[model samples]
Target: MLDTSTDIRLVKKAIRGSVDAYGELIEIHKNYLYRMAYLHSGTEDAALEIVQETILKGFHSIKTLRNPELFRSWITRILIHISIDFHRKSVPSIQIDENLPETRSLGISIEERLDLYEAIRQLPEKYRLVIVLKYFDDLKQDEIAGIMNIPRGTVAAYLTRARKELRRSLKEGYLNG
Candidate 1:
């Protein structure tokens, strides 16, 4: 991971049209962006496309970025916009069946995990987003608020409500047999 001062210097260089500096900065943040994209899109292919698009957009707008220190949040904001657009333009896939076979990947069985993801997927957009950005993306409440353009207190409220809804959904066996 690049230090803040190094990131700031790279951002400065990138803004001056230094492609190498830009590339280095992107490489440093690539994993973070990929994780966010994968969680948002729920597919490797889509996530890869989002990451590529994000890099392009970020590179193009590098000059407009006012704060070099906020590069991660700025790039992340761009990604969030692109992700929203991607989801808006794409057709939602219909699941034909809910019963999942037991298969372990990364030490977690598919049958057990699918239930959780299914429940999360069913949440209303606002609640689902807060949950995903908070837990999966590991973003702080303030960061989530900035991304969602909501107040910090609202983000907290949404999280509390989202957790409650998730608990109720899980308890009802909505996603489980």
Candidate 2:
């Protein structure tokens, strides 16, 4: 397997003018990109939309990116931007705690996992985005910062806030039950 850094180099070259190189880069990162989208969007349709749009924007804008080694984060940044655009145009509503399940079925209950995803979805977008990328996607803080175009400190802050909010949400769930 090509090391990730090696792949980035090839992708950079392809983005400049080499279609074959760009194609190879896409082949490598497409699955990861889709997964990242799916995790954040919480629906297959939105995830699929982000993935398709991200790839298209990446091709169109790749030449403007200076660091070839940062393609994963860069592409993710594009995906986030696309998602933000969609969110802004989406129907607005008051922030109510959304309905959730009560179990998580890995020997846990289905309701637990549903509750988890529901709580996560309730997080303010910035905090939720960081948590999803950091925990669900297993990305490092630095990488997340790059992807979000925020400082590492900001990413840490968002993560802290997200956890606190999630804990409170779950506590409320317990109380209500």
Candidate 3:
């Protein structure tokens, strides 16, 4: 991961029209963008397309970014918007990818992870987004609020409700299984 200083430098260069610097910045964050997109869209193809759109949009608007250190957040906001727009324009289809990376270090079995993802998929869009941004991306609530253009208190409320719903769903699944 690039340090904040390096990201700031690259952002400055990109703002000065250095395509190479911009390319490097995108490369550094590509995996994160892909993961975020995939979590939001639930399909590899949609994730790839969303990432591509995010790259293009970021490239065009790099100069408009006011804070260089917040590049990740800014680009992430773009990806989220694109993902939401993509979903709105297309028929919603949720398919679990069997080859999702293992989280054994976190002591989560594949079956459990799949069940959690399925539960997340069933959530409303705002709730799902909060859960993904908070848990999956490890973003702070304030950051999530900024990215989603919602109040911080709203982010907290959504997170609380989302977690509650997820727990209920997972518990029911467990009991039913």
Give model 2's TM-score versus the native structure. Answer: 0.81
Tens digits of per-residue lDDT, candidate 2, 1-177, equal 235777967876876788787778888988887777765666666677888988888888888878777777777888888877766665543232233212222243557655766687778889878977876677889888878888999999888888888879877432120
TM-score per candidate, in order?
A: 0.81, 0.81, 0.89
* Number of colliding residue pairs in each model: 0, 11, 0
* Full-model lDDT for every candidate: 0.77, 0.72, 0.83
Global local distance difference test of model 1: 0.77
Which portions of model 1 show Cα errors greater than 4 Å? Answer: 1-3, 94-109, 172-177
Top candidate, metric TM-score:
3
- C-alpha displacement of 74 in model 2, angstroms? 0.5
Estimate, for each residue in 78-135, the C-alpha lDDT of model 3 and write its tens digit.
9988988998997765787887743224356678877888888888889999988987
Which residue runs does candidate 3 get wrong by more than 4 Å?
Answer: 102-106, 172-177
